[model samples]
Each structure stands twice: as C-alpha cells, then as structure tokens.
Target chain A: MSTQIPKNLKYTKEHEWILIEGDTATVGITDFAQSALGDIVFCETPEVGTELAQGKTFGVVESIKSVSDLYSPVSGTVIEKNSDVEGSPEKINSNAYESWLIKVKVKNPGEISQLMTAEAYDQFCQTSA
Target chain B: MTLRTSLYQKHVDLKAKIVDFAGWDMPVQYTSVKDETLAVRKKVGVFDVSHMGEFFAEGPDAIKFIDSLVTNDIASAAMGKAIYSPLCRENGTVVDDLIVYKLAEQKLLICVNASNIQKDFEWMNAHAGKYDVRFTNKSEHYSLLALQGPESEGILKKFIPNLPSLEYYSVWESGQTIIARTGYTGEDGFEIFGSHEYIGKLWDQLIAAGVTPCGLASRDVLRLEVCYPLYGHELNDEITPLDAALAWTVKLNKTSFIGKTALTDYKPKYKLVKLLVEKAIPREGYHVVDENDGVIGVVTSGTMSVVLNQGVAFARISSDKFSKGQNYFIDIRQKKYPATLVTKPFVQGGHK
Candidate 1:
C-alpha cells in the first residue's frame, strides 16, 4: 500500500499497470506487484507481433523462490517488448513503472473502461492485503 | 502462531520477510534471495539455524546405542569428529538425516531437522530400550549459528582465535560453547552452538563485523547448488538413502545397523538426478518426461541459480526408465522444456 500508484495510469486486478498514449499503451507491473514478487531474476515476455488477450497470461516473471504469470491487461498486438528487462529482470524490482514489459496497439478500447483508476487500484490492493 | 527463535527480533529489525518454515517463524530473506546467496558465495554470511533440533546421547553405551540406529560407522568415528548419517527405519526408508558429533567416547551430540524433532525422538526412544544410553532432547537448550563463505574464517577468527586448528567436520569445545567446522552452504565455514544468551551476543558481534545475515531462502539455493540433500525435499520417510543417491552415507560393511538387513537387499527404484533446465524454471512437483513425453519422475527441488544464471533442479527419475545419455524434459504448466541431466554440484563451492 505504501508503493506508488501513479494517478494517470490504468490498473488491472492482477497488479499490471497501463500507460496509454494515443492508440498504443505501455504495460508493466505495479510497484506493489514487484515488491510482492521479491527479486525477479527472469522475465519471459511475448515477442513483438504476438496477439494478447485481456486477462490472459502473455508471459511469466520468475523470482528466486517463486514464479508468477504476467497477465495481459488489454487485448492488442505486441508492438514492442523490453529485451533489457528480459536480460536484467531486477530492473523491475528497482522501478517497475519505468521497466515496462511490453507496448501494445489497442484492439478494443472498451477494455480501458474495465480497468481501475489509481485510487480504485489502491483501495483494491489494501483490501487484498 | 508459529515459534520464534532468539534472533527473531533482529531479523525483524533488518526488515526480513518472514515465513513459517517447519512450524517456526523464520526469515526467508532480507533484501533478496539472490543478494544473500551471492554474498555467502563471495564474502561472508551468517544464518540463524537455531530452529534445528539438537539431542544429547550420553552413557556407557551411548556410542553403541547411537551406532545401532544410524547407517554409519559411528562407533569407530574418532573423537572430536562429526559423522553425517541417515537414521533409517526397519524397512530401509530414511527416518531423518542428521549429523552426529562425537564429543567423547560416552558423549555424543546429534542434530536433526527442526520438523523431524518429535518424530525422531520417539523413534530413537523406541529403539533404545535395550541399550543403557540416556537420550536427552536438548533442542530447547541450544541455539546454532552458521558463519559461512570464503571470508568466514577471517571474520569468525575475531572471536574464536583458535578456529584455524579445527578441521572440517570437527567440533571444538570452548567452555559451554561448541564450534564445528560444518555448514550446509558448501562454503568453508563453522557452525557455532551455545545458549540463547551467548548466541545472541555472538550474532550481534558477527553482524557488527560486517557479515551478511542470510535467511532460509538463500540457504536452500546454496545447498541445492552444491547438491546437498534436504530432509523434506531430497529425502523423506519413504525414500531410502540409496534411492536418493546418498549411498556414501550408508556404510554397508558395518556389522549391524538399523536398516542394514533391508538395505543389503534393497534395489533402487528411483535415481536422484540433477538437471540444467532450459526455457522455464522448474518447480517442485513438476513432472519430468522422456522424449515421447512419457512421465518418468517428479522434481523434488528446483531454483534459478544465481551463479549459473539458469534454472537447476533435482528430480527422482525411475531407475528402470532412465538410461545413460538419454534425453529428458521437464513439463511445466502444460509445456515440456528440454532438460539436460547434469552431474552433481551445479556450482563450484569454496569449501576447503
């Protein structure tokens, strides 16, 4: 709950955040998610041009002790994938927002309404915690 | 509520993430498992292994009584030396694997896993009816600290100056304190045992000397990299030492031991093998398959190695199904990832 929840971004219940710019959106895990997962050692993200469906697993993030599925928050085509984060996953631990995992071209803008705002996401995290 | 060790408050002060391990509220990691693990491999790190159980076997028949219950030649083991053995059941399955320190001919100290304390005590007492040995569960009276890594000796020498003379798997007594050159991390280090008050003081001293405080998470990664066996993971009540590829710990030539008769006729069903996994990181309970995707075994322990920068695991492959130079795959979440069966010790250790 103490982690930052930037107001301009949209959030998913799985703790992924979205930064919408025009018709494309940059996606990454929230600071809260990164902290909860501990030290991430490996990240497997969908390659560019791969189709992603909302609420489905597009990849995985592995910590030293556990592995978590990375859920795609919005349905779209993967335009760009962060290879730096894949090679050095600890960047997500240092700054999850800045270490965006993928950039997707929006397929359905209606899914954006289903995503929670920063305040709503904060309340969700508190209740789940 | 879980049990807490004497250093619980210290771990809290260091902001360690706590988890219930073997019924104890133990620290799993402080900063990260990767950092703590690397610190022990490169520098020095201290672990609060006080939750481990300790027992005392002392009497005129202590050596004979203890030797009869385990699968090692404890009776012939020299004084001041420690012998690792598997306490086996009558059927040759392991009851628990423990380290027995031969302090004197009539006095020995036994250390068991924390979760197996009660079960091991009951098992030992049931078998000690004929021998004149007195078994004392002294687990509550002791606290153990493992100071490990390449720089461990230099740091620990600050307190115990005579630490240089202690040989590996040997115990040195200093009044009521016991310092043994033994650790699970595969790093050259010492395991210090003493009362709660004395151990608390020693912990503070080691921390002040700039030793990294490690947790159970790093400890597992370190041990697995060295191919050391853990009770619940690589070993269990239903698995014999031979089945787990711990035949070295079983002295078959010994005249008489608990499971000697059964173990002599034992045929291995499972061959514990190490794997260097590709693609996905394998976890416990993951099925291991052959080229045709036929399930052959299950992974007991798996982790992403900080040193190797890859996923590594230990799996119990069916002996009849396994063949030398044959290919293997680990099935993870409906996907089969290619796994190469590798030799032991996934990482080179610093042990002397």
Candidate 2:
C-alpha cells in the first residue's frame, strides 16, 4: 500500500521525515517506514542535548519482527525528546508523522534543502517496494 | 527458492509480512502480531500450517515400530486418540517433538515438524529394521488449517456437522479429512487436515466469513504464553526431553524406545523453567546468569506477552534449586535485570 507523505516535509532516504520551523527540526519516521516495521513495541531515542550528525544513528525502533536503527535527518543537538513515544511506541505505528521523536536545533540549515521532496520520496518508496 | 504453501497467495493478498521460516515462505503477521495474538485469545484466528509434515506408519507392526522410535508409548493409545511425544535419538536428546495418531488397526499417523521432515523420515527409515512397518511421507499430500481461540468450536461447527464436539487430544476422520482437537496454542481449537484444494476452499470460506487470518508470529506468542516448547528453541538434537522438562512424555518403562537406555534414572543438570522478567524483554540466546555473573543457562524462547502485558521468558537453567520465587538476572544488551522463576501457562487459555 502506498503510504501518506505530506508535501511540506523533507524526507531522508532512510525513511525519516523532518519538519523545519525556524532553525528547529522535528524528526520522525515516515508512514512508509512505520508500516514496514509493523507494530512498534519499544523505541529508544537519544536523550535531550545529545549531539547528532546527519545520517547518523540516533536511536533504535524495535517491533515484533525486527529492530531498526533510527537515523538523524540533519546534524544538530537534540533539544527535546518525546518521552511519550518511549512509554508507548505504538504511537509511531498508528501516527508516524505526528509521533516526532526529537526536536533538534539544526547545525546546518542548508542540509534540510538537500533532502528529498514529497514527490521524490513517494517515487523512491514505490521503487524500493 | 523458498517453498510456498497453497494459501501463499492468500497471505500476500492479506498484506501479511512474509518471512522465510524453515525454508518455507510463511506469513509472520497480517496486520500486527499483537493484534493477531489478541484475536486468537479473545475471538478466533486461523493459521496456515501446510508446512508441517505428516507421515503414516502402516502394516502389522506399525504401533510397535512407532513405540520403539518415540519416547511416549504408542501401544496404550486407543483408536482415534493422539499422543504427544519426543522422537528422540540414541543419546536421549530430542530429534523432534511430534504427535502420533492411532487410526484403524495397525495404522498410525505421525505429525512432524516442517524443518525436521526429511531428517525424521531418514531416521525412522534407518530404524525400520525387521518390523513389517511401512513409512509413507504424506506431507505434500495434505494441507493443514488450525482454527484457534475461544470461538473456534462455533466456527468449526459450520462445516463439520457430524463432529458435534471433540475431547482433548482426540481425532475424528471423515473420509479424507481429519479433524483433531489439538493445537500448539493453549486455546480450544481444531486442526483440520485435507488436500490442498479442499484446504484452499476452506480458507476462502473462513476469510469470507471475516475470520482473522493469523500468522506464525502470533502462533509462537500464544504457544509461549502457554509454555509449549518449540522444537528448535526448547527441544533440539542436543537438548534431551528431561533437560527440557518434558519428562512426562518419556515413558522409560516401555520395552525399549530409541532413547530409553540413556534416559534411565535421568537427572538433568539443566532444567527448563518459566521466568517473568521485570521491564526488559529476553530473547533467545541471552544469558541466564546469577548474582556473581555465573552463566547458569541460556534462554530458549521468550516474548513480550500481549495478554500479560509483560515480558515472559523460558530458560534452561541448571538444577541448582531456584524454585518458589528464587531470583535471577537476564543479561540483555550487557545490562542485567532481576527476574523471578515461575510456573507455566503464563496466561490462562482454552474454554476448558
């Protein structure tokens, strides 16, 4: 099934999406990614203030089938972590885009522009599937 | 290429997440594991078990030959009765755990694991010896559907009008189809055995009736919750029936079984026990350690039980007396958490 991808969000090739507001970027997995992972049982994200590099591992998302590494969409310092997601990881499976894992203060604003647009990401998902 | 069952296309249509299980392309889940797990417990669910192998032992000495091969005595079982046993090797370790069905005089049906089909066949053939027993591999000829849960009786009653009710561990053969009141899951269920075409028709009827199509993942969780020992995980070539705490299945007093010699007065060093871990989940191959970091044994099978909503695990620990709430630790990802030894059937199952 084709997953929903908002036109405004920038997507990473690793199936993560980042929503930019000023210099802060709210990052989470896309619907395609969550659907592929099945039911999320446990999610472990980096603590607040943790430094992350672009395309680097920042957390882990585990499902009943397998565990996947959550990668950072952009280089930044995590300003906020979603404790609710850590408590109940099913939020990501139910509402992936809204279940933002972390809020990062972007180290490089230009990196957001380099990510794939909604149309490109949608095509990429189809090709991958 | 991975082998696909007759219902393989159906699982694909249901958007089931397919995984390679024992050289067969099988569905792990359709919607989600937890949801399917719940469906089997609360409502009704169906599992395509076509990969499981079936063999027949017929002729004059079928019962005697089968009894010599398995840990459980087959001669005592009445016709239409099924008995569970560990098909053991000479060293008393499990070759595979299977169910033997007693049919008309001198006829028996053996249900073996999919992964161990060829091995079991070869082993049984090698021991055929002087007995007038014929071993016929009927695995490819039959397709199996396990209709499980509390509502299984009602769903099963639709097609099987004659079979009003079945007692536990019993079988009723109606022409080519065999309905067994048995299941790996602790639910009140029935295993329907028929040809691929017949099973396909039954699968369509169940699907159209809005019955939940479950996968192997939910089946594993359900069986684990009931403390059923999976073949590869709990009983393997190296792990004996006594070590796996399946001593009840092993009747050493019987004339002479395959593993009876080694099993005489067997006191196992390692014992399988259920552990309820706090917070963290324990997976297979994780260490079951003590306070001083001594690795007592290893975890065999485990999962986050959906019914209990907690981490439940089964481990094979040494016989050092850790019963009645004796504490231990499970080494998961280099961190140790306190766990307690508990009895089985972690969640209550079945209409019985």
Candidate 3:
C-alpha cells in the first residue's frame, strides 16, 4: 500500500508527522500509521497546556485490533488538542494528514532538524516494510 | 520454522497481512479488521480455517468408544449430526473442546483447535487401547472454509443451487466433502470441509463472485462479540466447562464418561462474565477491579465491538467476590474504567 507523505511535513521514525508554522508545529500520525493501525476506534490526546518531551509518549491511538502510543517529534507544550479527532477517531483513518492531533509551541528548534524529510520518510517506510 | 497453509500464496496474492498464529503463518487481515468484521456482520465473508486439526475415528465400536472419552453423549447424536463436547482430564479440567461428527455407525470425524492438535490426538489415542477402534490424524489432508454472515446462504446457493437447507449443527456429506450449518461467528453460515484442491477452487470462485475474504483478526472480534469461547483465551487445562459457562455441553448423566465422576459435583470457583465498557477498551491480562479498586478478576479476551461501537470483554472473576448489582471496573493502565455486566452474546446475528 502506498502511504501519503506530504511534501511540506517532517516525520519521525515512530511514524508521527509535523507541519511547522512559525514557532508552532501541528502534529498527527502519518498515512502509514493509520493504515497499519486499521480503523481507529478511540484516540486519547494530551490536553492543551500539557508539556511534551521529544520522543516521549503524549497520547494514544487505539484501533479494533491494537493500541499504539503517540510520540512527540519535538519537545514543546500542547497549545491545541483536536477534539474533532477525539470524538471521531475514524477521521484519521479517512485522512490522516488532515486530521491533526495536536499543536505545540516548539521547545527546542534544533529537534526539527533531527526529523526526516518527506522523501526520507518514504524511503524509511519502504525499508521497514 | 513456522508452518504455512496451502492457501498461503493465495493470501499473499490478495495482499493479506500475515502473522504468526500458534506457530503457523496465517493471514490476520485482508483489508482492515473493522471492515472485514462488518462484512461478516452485515454481508458475506469467507475465512480460511484450515489450520484447525481434524481426526477421524472408524471402527464397529466407534460411537461407544468416542462417547466414553468426551463429556457429551455422542451415542444419541443422529447420523449426519454434529456434537460439541469438551475433552477433560481426570481432574475435570478441560483439555480441549471439539466437534464430533457422526458419519455412520462405524465412523466419525473429530475437529479440534490448531494448537491442541498433537495434545488432543495423543490424549485420545492413549485412552483408545481397550476399544476396537482406529484413529487417524487427517488435519493436513483437508481444508476448512467458513462462509459466514447474513448473505452466506445466498452466496453459497450460487455454488450448490440444488442442495437443501441444512439445519443448525447438521452436516451434509457427499463423498469427501462435508458442509455443515455451523460457525463460530454466530452467523447463519456453513463450514465446508473438503480436500485442499477443491477448497482452493471454491475460494477463487467466491472471491470472483465478490465475497470478501476475512482473516483471523476479524474472526477474533466476530467470535468475541458473540461470546464464543476461544481455546487458549477462554479455555485451558485449568478451566472447567462450568467456569467457562459451558455447563450445557457437559452431559454428566451419560453412561460414564472420562470426567463424569469429577464433573458430577463440580462447582467452579471462578466464573466468566461478559462486560461492556463504553469509555475504554480492556485487553487480555488487564485487571478487573471492584468499586473499592480491589482486584477481583482478570480479562481473558476483549475487543472494540464494531456493532455496538463500544468495548466488550470476557472476564474471569472470583465467583464469591463479585456481585451482579455491584459496580465493576477494568483497570487499564492504572486507570479504572467502569464496566457493566451484560448477557451472553453481546451482538445477535442471523443464525438460528
């Protein structure tokens, strides 16, 4: 299956994607994560104002068959939590890139440089598969 | 090394996700687990269950010999009828649950769980010394395909147009093929047991006819929703039939079975109960706690119910420590999620 990796986004090895806008970063799982997890039934995201550490678990995404931990790509504090995805987790399965889970104010800008580019992420997924 | 089924290539051709199941490389999903689950609930789905074990018993004393081993009275089961029973050890604990199909007065077929194939065969064979009977392990020679859901009968009619409707738990045999109106998904379905060559052809025909191919992940969700007992999850050597809410399957009055003496007065210390959790999902090994947060049980099997859009589980709780009117909660990740006790079969299907 071909996964969507937006050209404008940066990715983590854990399959999370981030779209930077100024100092804030919008975070969500990649298309590969959603398809791999199957139909997501429940999503638990950290509330706004919650602090996040880079590569640390901040949320959980549960599908019918399995549960996955959502890791933060960059250390920051959660400024927005997507209640829309919380109410309807299936949205992530439908359009993962569009269903952003959180928005964070970047704690350390250096972490952004450590993440993967779209092309690199595509290659990573291929090698892993 | 893991074993592969005859249809392993076919599953790969269909782009199925393979997983190691009981030492066998089996398909866990073709599309998505939820989609395949709904297909079986609302439409038709085909499943490859050839990993299950099959044993045949043939002799002039077949009925009596088989009847002496199981808890159920298979001697009374009419020809072409299938009987479900538990093979128990001397201590009244279950070894394996199997289906006994009486083909004739001198012949019968026994189907068991995949993981328990060798154990079940050895247990049965060791006890068959005195009876004039012959047993053969024929699991590798056959393939089992289950056509399940509300649309199953309609789709099967396209293949066997002239065949009559089979009653529940009834088998229709023609040569080496046996089609039984039996399934684990609680749906109006038929389990077709035949040679691998015939099953492979039928699988292609069904797929060409647009029937969805389901896998083990969906099968687990479907069976759990219907409150069916899985072998390793709900049943084990330590669990008795009474503990698993399968008392009806144990006919204690039958003319002296293996566990008759022990099961005659058996009272289970633990009882399995169904729970409905709307907020959080409970998984295996999760603790079941009471209102005071005291642990009282453990979850055996659980999943997100697609039909109810909630979490459902089977928990084995201490019989004396829990009450029907009291509040129960499942401890998931150190958080207590309230659980409501529900009746058998969290979802009803089209089956009788």
TM per candidate comes to 0.96, 0.93, 0.97
Candidates 1 and 3 compared: the better one by DockQ is: 3
lDDT winner between candidates 1 and 2: 1
Q: For model 2, what TM-score is found for chain B? A: 0.97
Residue-wise C-alpha lDDT for candidate 3, range B179-213, written one tens digit per residue: 88888898989998999999999899999999999
lDDT of 1 by residue, B271-321 (tens): 999999866688899999999999999999999988998889999999999
Off by over 4 Å in 2: A53-56, A107-115, B265-269, B318-326
Docking class of 2: medium
The Cα local distance difference test for each model comes to: 0.92, 0.88, 0.91
> lDDT at B93 for candidate 3?
91
- B-chain TM-scores per prediction: 0.98, 0.97, 0.98
Using Cα atoms, each model's DockQ against the true complex is: 0.76, 0.50, 0.84
Candidate 1 positional error at B346, Å: 1.2
Q: Candidate 2 DockQ score?
A: 0.50
